[model samples]
Target: MIIPAPPAPSTPWPLPRIKLHIEDLDHEGAAIFQGAVNARDALHLAVQASYRWLYTVDNPPPKVTQILLILRSMPGVAHTIGTGRDGMEKEIHFSLEYIVHSKARATAEIMGVLVHETVHCYQHNGKNTCPGGLIEGIADYVRLREGYGPPHWKRRGEGAQWDAGYETTGYFLAWIEDTYGAGTVSKLNHCMKNKSYHKRHFKDLTKCSVKKLWNAYCCLLKDDDGAKVLEILSARDDDD
Candidate 1:
């Protein structure tokens, strides 16, 4: 007897082909991954998170023909790279050793890393001129949106610069979205499409320089008041 599973819910965004490669199936990390999450579903969720956070329906995302997830015995966490000339094909190299080490929170950490790496597969890099911190922050922003942020992640801003990356920039972007309006971050991402990165883009998008934005954001974190944040952003910046 055979029974077909029900189709998954449809999304407005396109889904690329997904492939998985395990360097050592017998590794403990491999066992943890297999037991914790379904590879197909996790990867699909990761792509969906990236699309939802980084793109809009009218403004289509970059074409990603395929995403290959490779699990191997490596150090650190995971990283994604474009293998094709057009940058459509992406490979996410995830460390099995890292997985084994974080076994207690395997599923959450796995999904979080997947979302971050998948965002790299779809996010624009301002024609490769975008700052590295902002790029990593955007990836983490998507992960944060998907509720995969670990408990240890600080919700408030930190560091001397706005682009301190990871949760710092991710939370900053989130704050901008909450304050400016919906789709603010998406507009920021679109501005970088086929264009070089510059601090001016922040002013163009939010009517405030990046430095002012960061300053206001840091103040907001201290005060725990967003209404006050706008007042700081509205003031003109001569130093910008």
Candidate 2:
């Protein structure tokens, strides 16, 4: 029998007003972006992904009043900045150059980047004391959960540290959610809302310290048979 789809989020979190700014309408990236996705829908979907993965209906979202998407010539993929008097306004600066470079995979890459950057607009950062890597990882976790992970991402057995960031920590976070239960990552995110960053939060949520959790994850990866490894690596761009 076919299972019914999960119900859409019942409580609509207050969404910020979305705006877009293109530095050069004549740029090829502008044409590509416009062709790839509807600006309003893409931004709205990205915000929803952030809320869906990082929070629950019972939890009120952060007070972000506005988000401005800025596409321009930049050195990196993209980055977000919070402005306004209370820093409740967010601006996502996307790199036109990067978009042009990824022309073959433009649409998917654009959506993934939007989802990742949008997470930063809403995620808790332990009063800005959280590790930067963890922050980035959490963002990528939202992107991955939203079904926007890139073709190059891989689940591996090792990294320099648990908070190595991006897909490394993102997959680790996914593992934590899978092993513990749904909403484990959301709980982890909520735990840091009012407090500073601490490794103890992991123990509080998973009954294991972060270090121990990472070790267990590594051990699991190492012990997996070839088939299991393939299963782990099966989540790719095509899956999106």
Q: lDDT of each prediction vs. the true structure? A: 0.84, 0.84
TM-score of 2: 0.89
Q: After superposition, how far is residue 49 of candidate 1 from its true place, in Å?
A: 0.9
Give lDDT tens digits, candidate 1, residues 131-200: 9999988888777777887888885554567887898889889788877877788888898998999989
Query: Per-residue CA lDDT of candidate 2, range 1-240, in tens?
Result: 112222457877878999999999999999889988898899998988887888887765798999999999989899999999998999999998888898888888999999999999999989888999899999988888877888889876565588989998998998998788888988888988999988888878866678767766786777855455444434232211
TM-score of each: 0.91, 0.89
Off by over 4 Å in 2: 1-7, 225-240
Top-scoring candidate (lDDT):
1
> Which residue pairs clash within candidate 1?
none
The C-alpha stretches of model 1 lying farther than 4 A from their native spots are 1-11, 156-159, 225-228
- The window of 10 residues in a row where model 1 has the poorest summed lDDT is 1-10
C-alpha displacement of 61 in model 2, angstroms?
1.2
What residue pairs are clashing in model 2? Answer: none
